[model samples]
Target chain A: MTNKTPLVELRNMSIAFGGVRAVDDVSVDLYAGEVVGLLGHNGAGKSTLIKMLSGAYGADSGEIFINGEKAKIRNPRDARRYNIETIYQTLALADNLDAASNLFLGRELVTSLGFVDDDAMEAEMRKIMTRLNPNFQKFHEPVSALSGGQRQSVAIARAVYFDAKILIMDEPTAALGPQETQMVSELIKKLKAEGIGIFLISHDIHDVMTLCDRASVMKNGKLVGTVDVDTVTDDELLSMIILGKHPHQKEA
Target chain B: MSTPTTNRSAKTFFNKLGIDLRLLGMIGALVILCVMFDLITGGRFLTPRNLFNLSVQTASVAVMATGMVFVIVTRNIDLSVGSMLGFIGMTVGALQVYYFPDIVGLGHWSIWILASIAAIIMGACLGAVQGWVVGYLTVPAFIVTLGGLLIYRGAMWWVTQGQTVAPLDPTFRLLGGGADGTLGETLSWGGGVVSSLVAVGLILASRRRKANHGFTVKPMWAEGILIALAAGLVLGYVYIMNSYTIAKGALPRIAEARGIELTEGLTLYHGVAIPVIILLVVTIGMTLISTRTRFGRYVYATGGNPEAAELSGINTRMLTVKVFALMGALTGIAAIIASARLGAVDVGLGTLDELRVIAAAVIGGTALAGGFGTIYGAVIGALIMQTLQSGMASVGVDAPLQSIVVGLVLVFAVYIDIVYRRKTGA
Candidate 1:
């Protein structure tokens, strides 16, 4: 997988707010069909770093490359144009609107007369929801009526439907129960098999260990290190996350 | 999945109605108000003549309230609408009566058309300016529109030098519903019949569409009742307006004194006001924008969660600007209607309307917290407000007491809305 150009790469990214380095001197890459776990504690700058690529925030200093091509992501629209989409922890959905509206938020399906083609969008949403979760049936209710897992499914379906090449999911399973967590795990595997790159930011070591092929840990405002999940033990990854040091490099 | 479809033990009034709960709540409130006022006024409040007047009087507020629902839904307040109304009214009024009064005398059709277009453009510009400040400059809307409220009001007063402009062209006054601007008896009947047919057709089409989509719809009996009620409301309004006979009343009295026989049944009901027609168009058009357009959805989304909306590839800042701009243009339309309605423009044209407009939107269910509201609700809110005003005035309530009553009602409506939302967990 490393032999090909990465689907997305962030080189030497840094940003500051009020003279404090929130995300400083970090680098990460997501290859096609790979899930890269961005492991960090609270305020570990994982969100800030990923936001730079998602176009939620601009980097003060960095170079972002997609498909080995230089990119300029000045805004969320720009990021979307590059086929990059982010599912923020909040799911970035309009609670007052039903699944169809939320799914097509900025990109609504409209008739030739310029009116929103609501029925068509609902049909499309039904198709995707069926594909993603066969049990999901609450199509008419506003997303606020949906459960956490159902909302997550809608969010995931939105990204996948948009044909996002680089997907950024923040805390995908942080609030789910065991059943929902399992559903999410299955979805991620399906996405992976479809050859899409994903940056999954998580705090759970167990989740990262089982779901991610590689883990990049961050502490304070900088990267601690990246390690292959097969090569590093759970304790080694935890040590790097909390202590901000690579145990394997120190031992070498 | 465990959530109950309906809480039987805690069956709320809205649940009992069993339609779109939010929509039902608004309709129920409006109906309750009309009934209460009808009882107090000895059935005078629901008289067609009074309802007709009330609807015309509410035209401006209803129009502005349409835009306001969007503004409030986006979690933004436009304090300048009243002042903008005043400013645009004065500006447009000046163009017709003072600046280009002679153009119409030359028999050219450009005065009304040109002036209206210019006023709409001016309104859009003013709104865009405010939107820019709030959206891009990062100034809070409260602060920007607050400043605009003062500045525009001052500007309006200064423009007219506290003097009133009057005698707008006959054609221009049509926009305001001046005597000659009304549809009169024949047209009123015509409009009523046409609208009744259209309303029924719309209801049938909607029912058919729902069925086609395999969507659950209200029972046929309920749907038929709703359609009948809607059509009845339209035709009934026309019948009432046609009852005010003009030819036989004062003209007959003079002819009798002069010993000359006059035509017997020359009735001239105050026909449907032109401004009311304009208000109807605005209502329908805005309903479309609110329910069937991306801009409308984005407004709700932006208000629902600013951060989430932004992350979802929505340009909330630009959406904010557009929402305010649209509000500005509506205010301009309102200004035109208000000034035309009175056949004059003065500094007091839209005085204190900001409070009334916002009150209408809030009463209509647009939450100050944002994310929930409807254009129809706002229009109904305006109607309710107008009904209260007309009802009080007819009963000879003191002006000061009337205002106090209106204020209390506004607060009470909002209180009910909050309590209802809490109980329903909406």
Candidate 2:
């Protein structure tokens, strides 16, 4: 891979929630337009690290740099200003709102009269969906009626709608079927082509190997290491997470 | 896809009969009551004047009920609306007595404007305090607003010393009554002409806009029929007003009174009052806000899932506070109307008004759990309640019986809502 300045650099970031150090001294670099898979077991601090980037939690120590500049993200609003968006495992979509409405959510497209311009929003949503996920067509219906993959699309659309450059996806395809998983994989590829950095946290090595350009492993709130996906196998990454050491590094 | 298809089919069926079934059921009950009363009283209960009286009578509560929809939709109850109304009305009343004479020696429109602004601001401040407690401090909305109810009403008691303050300026009286008279005034010929034209234009414009937006507009035939019916109602009202004699040969019929008396014809009570008009305008404005605005979307989203909304970068607490503040302001407006109607402000001005407003909203199909309601629905709900109360009183029904009937109706409405929700699984 060509060397480029990382889009997001988390340096020695630590977050503790009531005596529990969810993320401790984790430093990670995410490049522009790259998919970096974060592999970890349950409570391995991957989610907490991502949450810090998404402004769900404030870092107790260390710093977060966006586009090579030190950033202070106090809340989700600040995170959005830094073009960092997160889609949690729950997706955080309003079920009653339709796809177009949910995509705009709090920041809706309004007409000159200050009323929500549903037509303009629908048109924009159609364009985005067509470009990203062609299979997603339920526009008028609420997101609650959408399939798992479609709901994920809506969540992604919401982040992307706000011009999010760095996306933190928390197990986006955790509960999807085979077809849905494929759809999400294709969506990830599209996002990569759009030059948006994605930090994908998942337990599925197959997904990481199939979708990620690089994979990072974390164990017990500490980073094991980052490795190129092309040079490693699923078993190698699994061993990295479980054993907390690279096979080659041990020999070295 | 298959599930939604089947669900849509079921929804269509329900729409055919059960859509607005609450309103229909209420109307049916009202008709039954009228028939029973007519049978018992030998048709005195079936008079046109009584029906007209019912419309004017239910106006204030109906207005407050519309505001209550906003409060209830957010899954919060505003028990303080009634008290806020009393407080604002008394404030306005006190301003007319004390503040107005000291400033411009009364009879100035600016004084009324200032008084209204002061009352509304005071109500909003009170509401903001409650909203801050409920939204920021995480206090329960019910307890906060309930405390608000007691505190505001107590303030009202202290302000007026538990006595009725009256002799309100004529301008204030016009707010409750009309420009010309009391509560029985039907539209004059000129008013009838203007109202009919405005109604038709509004209906057509709305239909066209809906169609342009790809929304299903009601059939043109249905719209035309509705417009025709409205015109007929206006014409009939004009006829009734022209024919009625206030006092035998009280004055000579003037030029304006020839076709349909403008000056000496029917009193202002013969037509829609200013307060009724205010209620309609507020209801329409609020309905538009709820259905069309970005803030309205946030209101729905915040109620639907607070965590999701917050995660989506919405200021959920701020929206809650804004809504609560709006409810308070509306309550103040309602207080002004109520005070005008009663011609005085006292401690009992807004007592039990909150219960009535809440019951109206609940009966109108707003869930106490939040995220599902409309201002129109709430108004209809209030009208149903008011109709029941007025009709019962006309039949000489006792207060205890009235209470029992209202409570039963509330339970029945809620039960229907639960069953409908279960059946639809929405």
Top lDDT prediction, candidate number? 1
For candidate 2, give the docking quality class from DockQ. medium
Runs with alpha carbons beyond 4 Å of true place in candidate 2: A1-3, A130-138, A243-252, B1-48, B178-269
Which candidate ranks first by DockQ, i.e. highest? 1
Task: List all candidate RMSDs to the true structure.
Answer: 4.1, 4.6
Residue A141 in model 2: shift from native, Å?
3.4
Q: List model 1's recovered fraction of native interface contacts, to 2 decimals.
A: 0.72
In angstroms, the error of model 2 at A40 is 2.0
Q: Kindly list the per-residue Cα lDDT of model 2 for residues A70-175, writing each as its tens digit.
A: 9998778889888888888999887767898888886788889899977778878988898768888888777877888888888877877777799899998886
**Quick one: how many clashes does candidate 1 have?**
2
Model 2, B1-426: lDDT tens digits are: 469889788666545432444555655666676687777767776565565456556667777787677777777888888887887888788888777878887677676677667777877787888888998998989999888888888888787787778777766766664323333343356766787898899778767765676656566666777788768866675555444434434333322332455553443224444675677678878888887898888887776667888877788888878888888787777777777777777767877888999998888888887777778778868877877787778778899999999899889988988887566444
For model 2, what is the alpha-carbon lDDT of residue A94? 78
Q: What TM-score fits each model?
A: 0.93, 0.87
lDDT of 1 by residue, B85-135 (tens): 999999888888776757655425677887788778888889989999999
